[model samples]
Target: MNPVSVTDYRQLAKKRLPHFLFEYIDGGSYAETTLGRNMADLERVALRQRVLTDVSSLDLSVELFGQSLSMPVALAPIGLAGMNARRGEVQAARAAAVAGVPFCLSTVSACSLDEVARSTAKPFWFQLYMIRDRAFMRDLLGSARRLGCSALVLTADMPVPGSRYRDYRSGLAGAPGLRGNLRRVAQSVCRPGWAWDVGINGRPHQLGNVAPILGNNSGMDDFFAWMRDNFDPGVTWKDIDFVRGEWGGPLIVKGILDPEDARSAVAEGVDGIVVSNHGGRQLDGVLSSVKALPPIVDAVGDKATVLVDGGVRSGLDVVRMLALGAQGVLLGRAWAYALGARGEAGVTHMLKIIAAEIAVAMALTGCRNIEAIDRDILAELGQDINSRL
Candidate 1:
């Protein structure tokens, strides 16, 4: 079948990937209420289409952090992408390169930063996790700088890993010590392609930037233990200052919900702030990132670039986010599904489809550029979205 959209790629991914892998990418935290609400809130935003305007020469380009982007949309930092396809992170980064957009590599990626950066033609952004060890965190930032990373994204939400039942059942999350090693071997045999292509041929599963701190295939349990011990629970604005001093580059603080946090991020001198709930993977009952964007946009004013990521699947959702005041949008599961479907080719196709969709939406709405989108074009369909935030 010819996959022409992200949804099409998602359908193909479900068929190609194992049940557990599919669920891990597709499912959110327990009950998935926030997951479902994220999409619902985006859909509730109705576009006020304008006619009789010449949008013939539409400009989707956006200049962020002094660099011009082909589009304001970027690929969110997705973890363990190597599990989706053979050398999946490399493939996805290549796709982002071809699409003329940025791809953020996660702290928990299966493929190392060096491998992904080497595969792509352009430099990409690196997302960092604030760990308890200041020295280890410093080393990770230094590695990113050495790799010529364009930006440093500090994810602030995950003090502790959320309980994902899907991963637990898939034998990927909570395992029974060394006994689970036997189970993993059996599962690998079942998925020979994954075993041979990713497990055998590709870089071994390890956080590339943190290798000196956490060594190779230390098993999931030990990794989780490391995470528990390393994650700084009392992360403050001072830590943000510390990172800024060390990196000396564009810094983005992700996982911000409160408008006060957004204001603080701007005050702390962040280049951008991502109004995210960790894609609904961390907190369940919290307001969706989309729903929380307007207030943050209002709070920060023009101090910093505001990007939001959560339940962002379609081009229409991208438009809605812009209309609500996001400088850019990020995708997590959408591209993950594409990577799972046909590796780099699928991801490239997905980007093309989204670009085409965005152009169409812009033409219909009488907007010629991403910067023209505003609150006047959006109408809320559900409970007062303004008050929800």
Candidate 2:
């Protein structure tokens, strides 16, 4: 069957990838309560449709960080994306360029920053994780600057990695023992297509960004260990000053849920703030990004561009976020699912689906342009959801 929605891509990805890798992308931390809430709360938002409105010329274009985007959507950074397909990050970057959207590459991605830069002429964004090594961090910042990255997304939520039960069960965590190795080998043997396309043909399986720091022969186990040892637990707002000193381009601080943090980010001089909960992969019981968005928007929307990411699956969901006062929305698992399912073609297809959906939704809601979307376009289902926020 042909895939039509992001969820359809997810299903296809599950079938094509090894079980452990699929769960790593699909599962959330702990009981995944916040993960489930992200979508559930978005579904609760109802759009106020109107008839007899002139919707002849629909404009979905949005200007962000001095760049014109075809739509108010971007593909979020996902680590180990190369494991999904043959040089998956490069493929996804090319797709994002074709779709005229920013593609943020993770510091832990399978393709190096230079490799992706050489693959596409479009200026992509880079997501940074504040590691313990100051020298390595500086080197990464220099590389991004040299590569002409349009933006630097500093993730602040994961001071420490969340305890994902699925990772443990799938043997992604814990020591790499003989049994776990055998189990992974057996799983790879079963998924011959994945093994051939990504495992065998997609050589240089090491984390491209950190391979120099951990040596050229480093593998998944070494990457995990490096993460455990390097992710600084005592990161403070002062680190923002350090990053600002290094990166002169557009700076975005991701993983913000609280209004206070949003305020602090503005004071720290970030150009944009992503009101996210790490897609519920980080704190499981925290408020969903949708629920947390309004306050943050009210707090810092004027000072900095407010973007959101969490459980945003369809074009209508993007509309909901825009109506709630977000400048744009970042999609994490959606594009990853597409890339895993059908590589570059799947990503391009997914973007077309979402763009078409957004246009249709805007027309149905009496919005002739994206800038006209506001809270007035929303109606309470039964209770005052805005009051709750």
Candidate 3:
């Protein structure tokens, strides 16, 4: 296939990856109601078209967190994301750097922080969860600082992991012991391309950052068990202080869906807020990030930068998110699918597709720059951004 769209890349990814790995990236929590809503709600937003406007000149650039972004986009932190390709996180980071955007490496990434930092000339962001091990967390932050991390994204969700039935059925989780490993191995055997590329040749199979604690454990079962034991559920806003003590950078809080929590994050001094439902992997019935955006934007005013992620598959969706009042958009699954399908080249192509779409959408909508995007670009211009969120 020509693979001009993210959907095409997703198809390629599905065909090349083993079933368990594909399902791990593709599925959401039980029932996946919010998962579906994210894309559906963005599609529901109607763009107001204006022809014959002077859009001969267009600028997609935007300044975010003191960094000038080629576009208002960043790669969201996805757990086990690097599993999609051999040294996948490192490959994606290189792509993002070349494209002039930020790539936030997950705490559970396959490639360690130092490895990614050393690979890219532009500093990437780091995503952290408040695990039970504060000493470990402190040391990790120190490393990020030494490596010159540009920003810190605190994933304030997943205090307790959500229930994903797909993981259990595919042997990605739940099905432990020899049975699950055999099932995954059988599935891998069916996809010899992935087996050779990732299974046989993919080096440093364990979660790199936490590998010290994991020791000889590199299996999915071991990762799940570690999360079951280490993820801290008693975390509160006060915990941000501990994180602040270790490093100083733009602190972004992800997984916010309510205006109240948005206000609270601003109160605790978050530099940015990502209105998300963990790509619908953490919560099943919550509102989509698009639906949840307006009120949070209203609540925070200009106190912090507000970014939205979840169901952002194309450039048009990026325009829709900006029109709805998000300062920028974060991409999760789109980049992952691209990475799995064609490695770094696929990621670069997917981003090109989005950038082109954004340009066309802006030209048609009578805007020549990113700053001109607002509710006015929506068909429901006078409706106050539909604040029922």
Candidate 4:
């Protein structure tokens, strides 16, 4: 496949990657209702077609947290991202830099923040999971600060990792000991491309951020074990101040689905709030990010920077998110699939595909610029647009 669309890239990724790796990026929590809703809802969102409007001179640019973006899209922080390709996060960061957008590196990414910073001088964002070890958290924060990271994204959800049935079935999680190892080996062998590209060649397979603490236990087992042991479930809003004190940069709180929580994030003075359900991976029964967006926008659009993620599969979907009132949209699975399928070149092309889609969508909607994107561009506002299309 030439992979002209993100969906095409996803198909390519499925063929090229091992089953466990594909499942890791593609699957959601138990039932995955929210995940389905995330995509279905966005697809049903109709864009109002306007005729004879002067959209010839279009500008898709937008500025967030003092950083300029070619479009309102960022490569979201995804764990084990590097395993998808050789130094996947670094490659994605380079693509983002060239595309003039932000790439947020997950703390559990295959490549560390230092590695990405070294590879690309373009400032990237670092995402932090609340770890039980506050000292280690401080070290990570200090590293971000010292590396001149443009922003710090603190994921507020996922204190307790969600129960993903797909991970267990695919042997990425739960299945352990010799049998699990054999299963993963067998799966990797089935996809020889992945085995050679990542398995044999992608050395030191350690989850980079915590590699220091992992010591000799630096493998897939330690990656999951460390997350299981260190994830802090008892976190509250006030705990953010500890992070606020440690770092001085644009602090964005991701995974806010409720307006009350969005309001609370505003009360805590976060620079931005990513209206997300962790891409429907964390909580399965909650509202989709788009479904949760309008209310949250009503609650804090004026107060905080509102960005959204989940089921943003296309550039039309990007415009849909912006129309629903997100200043930006984050690409999690979209970029992950692209990287797995084609490496840096795949990422670069995926972005071009999205940019083209956004431009076309904007031109059709008669939106010449980002500021013109509002509820008005929606085809029909109150016609019960929530049903699955």
Candidate 5:
């Protein structure tokens, strides 16, 4: 099929990936109420069409964290991406660099910080997970600095891994060697191209950032056990202060959905905050990140850059998020699924499609720059808070 949108890439990913791995990327927590709502709430937002406006030359560029972005979009940190494709993190980073955007590498990624940075000329961002040991966290930050990372994204969610019934049912958490091998073989038979390239020719994946502290988890259950024991639930704002003091660079707090928390991050001096629910993987019944964006944007009062992730699948959804006051949007599963489907080329295509859509949307909405998008668009949609979110 000819892919023209992120959803088309998702269909390709579903066809290429093993069922268990596909479910891991596609499924959410519990009943997935929050997952579905994320996209639905964004769809509820209405855009105003203008008949007379000179948008002949549109500029989607924006200055974020002292970096001039070609467009107001960044790739969110996604875990276990290497399992989706061989050296997937590096592939995705290269794609982001080609598209002129920042790609945040997750702490749990199969590729190392140095590896991803070496793969791209652009300064990629690094996402950190505050483990139970402060010394380890310090070492991780030092490693990122050594790799010349431009930003530190502290993921505050996942103190404990959320319950995913699909993984449990598929036995993905146990019997890693035999079960995983068999599953891959079967999936490769289904998608010969992906199998020959990723499954056969790909190198053995390792978690580059954490390989020193913890070995590559051979079994899913082993990984879950290690994570449950090591993750620090007692992490507090003081931890953020310590990281900021150590890094001395742009520090972005992710997984924030509350207005008070956003305000606190600003007062405590964070450079940015991403309004996300861990892509609906951490919490089940919480409000969608889009629903939480308005209040958080209001609370920050322009003190820090505000970005959001979760259910941002299309260019129109990006428009809705910007209209709701988000400074930018994060592409989570969008790029990951694309990489799984067609390696680097698929991701590059996905980025271009979204960019063109944003430009067209801006032209139709009577807005020239991203900053011109405001709450006024909501009035034209006849949308109320209760009705939309």
Candidate 6:
């Protein structure tokens, strides 16, 4: 398959990856109600069409955090990206640099910060998860600064990991001990292409970022055990103060979905807030990011940059988010699917498809640029909300 759309890339990824790894990337929390709703609610948004508008000169560029972006989209952080392809984070960072957009590296990434920084000329953003080890967190911040990271994204969602049943059922969580490990190996045997490309050729299969702390020879089960032991569940607002004091650069609080939390984030002096539900991987029944965006935008006003992620599949979905009051959109599974399907080339193709789609959507909607996209482009916000209910 040529794979023109993100969905096509996803199908390709499913076929190329082992069953356990594929389910880990594609599945969500228990019941997956919010996961399904994120995309469904985005489809519910109606776009207004107009003709005879002069859109001959279209600019997809936008300024984010004092940096000019070729488009108002960034790749969201995803763990175990290296498992998808050999040195996947490095490949994804290069793709983002070529596309002229930001790529946020996950704390649990397969590649180290220094490796990615050395590979790309453009400085990329780093995403942090506040674990129980305060000294380690502080040192990680120092490392990010020394590497010249453009921004620090503090993901406030997963104080504890969500209950993803798919992970358990697929033997991804190493639940059934030796039996599960044997099952995973058997599944890998079925997909010899993936086994050779990722399992054999993708050497250094451990989590690179935490290798120094958790040993370089650690495996997926060891990383999971470390996360289970160290993820701090007692974090509070004061922890934000600690992060602010340590990192002097732009700090974005991810996983914010409530207007009250948005107000508190402004009060806490965050540079930006991502209206996300951890891409519906954390919470199960919460409102979709789009439905949760308007009130948060109303609450924060211009005090902070309000970006969004979750169920953003295409450029039109990006337009719908901008119309609903998001300054930018972060793509999670979309880019991951592409990366797993065709490595860096697949990622570059996916970005081009989205950019072209956004241009066409902007031309048809009578909007000349991203700034012209507002709530008015959406057909009756009240009716759309009612329909979702």
* Alpha-carbon TM-score of each model against the true structure: 0.94, 0.98, 0.98, 0.98, 0.95, 0.97
Error of 1 at 140 (Å): 1.5
Q: Which candidate would rank higher by TM-score, 1 or 6?
A: 6
Please, what are the lDDT tens digits per residue for candidate 5 over residues 1-389?
98988989999899988777788889888888889888887777778788689998888889788888889999989888877787889999998898888999999887888888778888989999889988988888988998888988999877788887767555565446677657656756777766667667765555667777666563455566767888988989888878986798899999898998998899889999999998888889999988899889888987999999999998778888998889989999999889888888888999998899998888888888888878876644344353556
**Candidate 2 TM-score to native:** 0.98
Badly placed stretches (over 4 Å) of model 6 are 174-176, 383-389
* RMSD to truth, every model: 2.2, 1.4, 1.2, 1.4, 2.0, 1.4
Report the Cα lDDT for residue 359, model 3: 95
Runs off by more than 4 Å, candidate 3: 382-384, 387-389
Q: Would you list the C-alpha lDDT of every candidate in the order shown?
A: 0.83, 0.91, 0.91, 0.92, 0.84, 0.90
Mind giving the per-residue lDDT tens digits that candidate 6 earns over 201-287?
Answer: 988888788888898537667878888888899998889999988899999999999999999999999999999998778979999
Ranking by TM-score: 3, 4, 2, 6, 5, 1
- Model 5 residue 17 lDDT? 85
Clashes of each: 1, 0, 0, 0, 1, 0
Which lDDT value does model 6 have at 319? Answer: 97
Record all residue pairs in model 2 with backbone atoms less than 3 Å apart, i.e. clashing.
none
Residue 143 lDDT in candidate 3:
92
Lowest lDDT 10-mer window, candidate 1? 380-389
Off by over 4 Å in 5: 174-190, 216-219, 380-387
Better model by lDDT, 1 or 2?
2
Cα lDDT, model 4, residue 280: 84
Across 154-209, the per-residue lDDT of candidate 2 in tens digits comes to 99999998888988788766647677767777888889999999889998888999
How far does residue 123 in candidate 5 sit from its true spot (Å)?
Answer: 0.4
Instruction: Please identify model 4 stretches exceeding 4 Å from their true place.
Output: 383-389
